[model samples]
Target: MRNTLNQRRSTRQHFRLLEQLLVATILLQLLNKPAVPVLSTLLQILLLAWL
Candidate 1:
């Protein structure tokens, strides 16, 4: 039981980090090219799928 709990915690942390990275990437892309709506929409879709 304890091992399972630890594994779950680790997985949660990994997903949290991934979420932050994705958000940062989205922000950077938007900042670098505000005119690229297609890429932005794709990233938003990817983020939504993850959630």
Candidate 2:
């Protein structure tokens, strides 16, 4: 019974860690947009010229 409780606690901790990681990834993507969005848009325009 004690082992089962420990397992549950560990699983909850893992889920919390995953949630934090997902939030961090989303925040990083948002932070990158201002720096990269225009570059990507320009690249798309160049690609269109090629096709």
Candidate 3:
């Protein structure tokens, strides 16, 4: 039972890390593109954070 709990904990941690990386990558891409307006970018960031 303890081993199972540890496994689940590790899996959750991994997923959270992946989610953060995905958000960062998307934000970076948006920043790199010159056409994205500031309001849209802020909205996108807020949306991602909400998720």
Best by lDDT: 1
lDDT of 1 by residue, 1-51 (tens): 999999899779868866776676678776886655775676677567756
Task: Report clash pairs, candidate 3.
Answer: none
Q: What is the TM-score (0 to 1) of candidate 3?
A: 0.62
Task: Write candidate 3's Cα lDDT for 1-51 as tens digits.
Answer: 999999889778866876685666678677786544654566567557645
Give the winner by lDDT: 1 or 2: 1
Worst 10 residues of 2 by lDDT: 42-51
Regions more than 4 Å wrong, model 2 = 33-51
List the candidates' TM-scores in order.
0.62, 0.62, 0.62
lDDT of each: 0.73, 0.63, 0.67
- On residues 1-51, what C-alpha lDDT tens digit does candidate 2 reach at each position? 999999889778766765665565567567875645555565456446544
Kindly report which residue pairs in candidate 2 clash with one another.
Answer: none
Question: Residue 34 error for model 2, in Å?
Answer: 12
Instruction: Let me know the TM-score candidate 1 reaches against the reference structure.
Output: 0.62
What clash count does candidate 1 reach?
A: 0
Candidate 1, lDDT over the whole model: 0.73
